[model samples]
Target: MAVTILGMDIGGTNLRSGFVNDRFELSEFRISSSQAICGEKAPENIAAYIERLMAETGIRPDAISIGFPSTLDKARKRLLSTPNLEGLDDMNMVERLENALHIPVYIDRDVNLLFLCDCHANHLTADVIIGCYVGTGFGNVIAIGGEILVGKNGVAAELGHIPVRGLTLDCPCGNVGCVEMIASGKALKTLQETWYPEEAIGTLFTLHASDEPVRGFINDLALPIATEINILDPDEIILGGGVLQMDGFPKGALEDAIRLHARKPYPEQALRFHYSGEKQENGVIGAAILAFRHMKREKGQPV
Candidate 1:
């Protein structure tokens, strides 16, 4: 029988899980709502969720790996904080889950998981890759030499909260003018409400080629990418998220805008663009990769 690892990706709205072998071939992928938990009930409900998944799959996992949309602590043993998911912040997930399940648990910020996905899926040659995903929110994950740049607090890559133009918009993290507010799904909604009051989101891209307001919103959102590029100068930049998947979206326009704002010396010439397509399986795949890597590390092996 193949040794399998269980993986979970916990987001604000969705919780995704899967099982995979050493090669990252996923099996028994499942997605469920995050509404099953509230405050102190989260650990209990999360345990139930994992048990149900295992029961459904009939797979006894060798280990468990989880990705949280939050900052992990210095030791990677505690959940330090999460700007979006309030209940998970300051929670001792590593200890609680490991004790509850009798399995080793590994957790990291979700953006780092995205970076792992991009590296494996794209077969990127660059040693340093920066992944910027703009969706319901914005997130960043930076990896150098095939390892994550986990800082002292494991909160190194909070790239989306960096202030720009001091523009104040209400952010879920209780901050004003966060990069997410200016560049994320919320930003898209704000722009739609302000400029294209009569248009639907699915059609915004299609209409933008001719509509002034839609065009303006796209350009405005592109500014955040410009800011990130100017600072990080990543060896390779991967852009993925829901907004980029819209029909008739102007891919060339966004790339050109990014290039225009990036530094001329390196980032402009080496910038790489990738759309994650419309598949919802990315989270599951990423989760699987996380588990596979962790299992290898624990076994005194290399990934």
Candidate 2:
């Protein structure tokens, strides 16, 4: 019998959920405000919402997989922090949700799930791939031999929090000097608010692509990619986020900045880039794929 999996993508702004079909497509898709689904960021509220969704859609799942915009613990059982969304920090979601739903729940970093989905969408065959997604926060994920790289502490590919030498901007991660402070959509929004309050948020890149501050933003965005390329020399790299998808954003300038900062001759020249999709269901689809892999493993099959 085919396995039934419920997949969810929990972000700062929205909660996307659906079931994955054989074609790697989403079925019975639904979207709701993150606050609505995880009211007050409570685990119990999240459990209740899932119950409501199942009741409304009449799609009882055999298993559940979720991608969260937060750091997962070594066991993938709880979120260590949700800098963008409050009250979810250090919460044991897997145990709680499983208890409520009476089914297995698998969880992972949102970027890891996104990386999984993007690779499948792009038909990538690389042995190593690194993904950097710059949305409300800077998210990084690495896969080697089809496995997500979780370090000793399960926080391995935390490229976003890698500190800048002299930056001291406060990060919601309870840390100062984090790279996300300067390289994410949050960074661009900060720039827009402080320096160009008259300009609209979506048009910051469109209107100020050449301004010194925006230029600095571009360079800051490239820092992690260049640094990763030099270190990992990954088979492929993916760069995506709300910032990159914005109209009039200088994709070329960002690429150029990456190349300039990356070491010459080898890693820089070998760079292969893949852009992540903008579909509404991409993250949920990714979560579904993640569930599929876990189901395979549970069935004593290879992933």
List pairs with backbone clashes in candidate 1.
169-177
TM-score of each: 0.92, 0.96
For all the candidates, what are their Cα RMSDs to the real structure? 2.0, 1.4
Off by over 4 Å in 1: none
- Tens-digit lDDT track for model 2 on 1-303? 666778899999989889887577578888888876554657788888889888999888888899888888888998898877767888899998888889889999888888888999899868889999999888898889888889998999988888889898998888899998999998888899999999898888777899999999999999988998888888998988778889888988989999998888888888888889988888898898888888888789998
TM-score of model number 1? 0.92
lDDT of 1 by residue, 84-116 (tens): 564787888988888888877778777677667
Determine which window of 10 residues in candidate 2 has minimal summed lDDT: 35-44
Which numbered prediction scores highest in lDDT against the true structure? 2
lDDT of 2 at 68: 86
* Candidate 2 lDDT for residue 185: 91
lDDT of 2 at 86: 65
